[model samples]
Target: MMPKFTHIENDRAKMVDISGKGEVVREATAAGKIFLRPETLKAIREGTVMKGNVLATARVAATLAVKNTASIIPMCHPIPISSISVDFTDCEGYIEAVVVVKMTGRTGVEMEALTGVSVALLTVWDMVKSAEKDAAGQYPVTAITDIRVVEKKKGK
Candidate 1:
């Protein structure tokens, strides 16, 4: 048996329709972690990263990503996002980016939240790539992982 896909109909790919659903307040929170070398983490902590304030830059990137997620993801519906929040947590040898997206619409904002977290983590990596690179100019110790929607809520 073939698995069903919400974006597929009659052997054609299509965007899912939420038009018949009533408008509701929807929110989603997503999180991802970027692992870095000890030195890279220290540089971010000391505000000495070459690019600039890493978290602030990431936050802006996340906000934009949330708003533009529909463009990047073909099946995602264009949603009216009411609020977006981005936050970062500094931990041992890693940093975590969390994004929360809220909107009153027929569809949920999980894709937007996931996109925000992904872009935020990527921005963090870009900001610190110089410090994270080895003599061979490779990022052997840098990685982004665990991108997921940690929370989703909807209310009438």
Candidate 2:
């Protein structure tokens, strides 16, 4: 029979204990999209977004976000991240950003990867919004449509 659900002895919320789990290397990749106006897209492509580098700033922000993921998410266990890569692609009317996080530790780095992508996108939006805001003074809409782990491998 499958095990039945049981509450923790003293806590009201359920939590997973990783103390007994074997340490293993794990990695996760997450991606997100940012839709923008034609002019905004051109500015980014032409290297003229407020005289700032959108992709470069986003990349740095993503790396920092990955390292601080645990502080932002309550249940995430702080893990030592080995490397992080952020990529940006220009899609005619939109921009796609991808963040891949790698770690050699006991816990998976899925949250870190996701957090990186999210914060990076937000930073991009902030940098361009001043020029991309609509006539009504509302910022261009940004969305994080999908976030998922694309790959995983168990360490030997």
Candidate 3:
């Protein structure tokens, strides 16, 4: 049998009830990469993206995005977030953003983590788009890819 949709009832969308569920320590990590041109990458590395520090700006955006995930995603509960961390890794022609979120609540924080990574990567794109855009005014080399939750853990 197919699984039932958690947010649908009586053919309408609705929020899940988690009031009865016991609060537990929840953690989740997500990651994604954004491909950029070599010149753009060098500019990012040299802290000369013009939009200011790419990683630092993205980190702040990720943190804020994680905290506001519930507000943005319908059906998500407004749970208290205990901690959040954003990290980055540079590859051959791309940059990876990893976001981790922790909470002691009735529900997990997987969505929040994923949202953080996505927003962070998008922030990177915005920061470097000017440098990567071609004469056609398009971002041919700028792309956000492989966004996924890498880890999740509950209460100890």
Which is superior by TM-score, 2 or 3?
3
**TM match of model 1 to true structure:** 0.91
Please state every model's RMSD to the true fold in angstroms: 4.2, 5.8, 4.4
Q: Which ten residues in a row are the worst by lDDT in model 3?
A: 4-13
Q: TM-scores for all candidates?
A: 0.91, 0.85, 0.92
Top-down TM-score ranking: 3, 1, 2
Query: Mind giving the per-residue lDDT tens digits that candidate 2 earns over 66-148?
Result: 99998999888999898899998898678888888887877888899999989988888888988877789886554445555
Q: In candidate 2, which residue pairs clash?
A: none
lDDT for model 2 comes to 0.84
- Worst 10-residue lDDT window, candidate 2: 140-149
Model 2, position 99, has a per-residue lDDT of 87
Whole-model lDDT per candidate: 0.93, 0.84, 0.93
Taking all chains together, the TM-score of candidate 2 against the true structure is: 0.85
lDDT of 1 by residue, 14-124 (tens): 888778999999999999999999988888889999899998999999999999999999899999999999999999889999999999999999999999999999999
**If both were scored by lDDT, which would come out higher, candidate 2 or candidate 3?**
3
Error of 1 at 37 (Å): 1.0
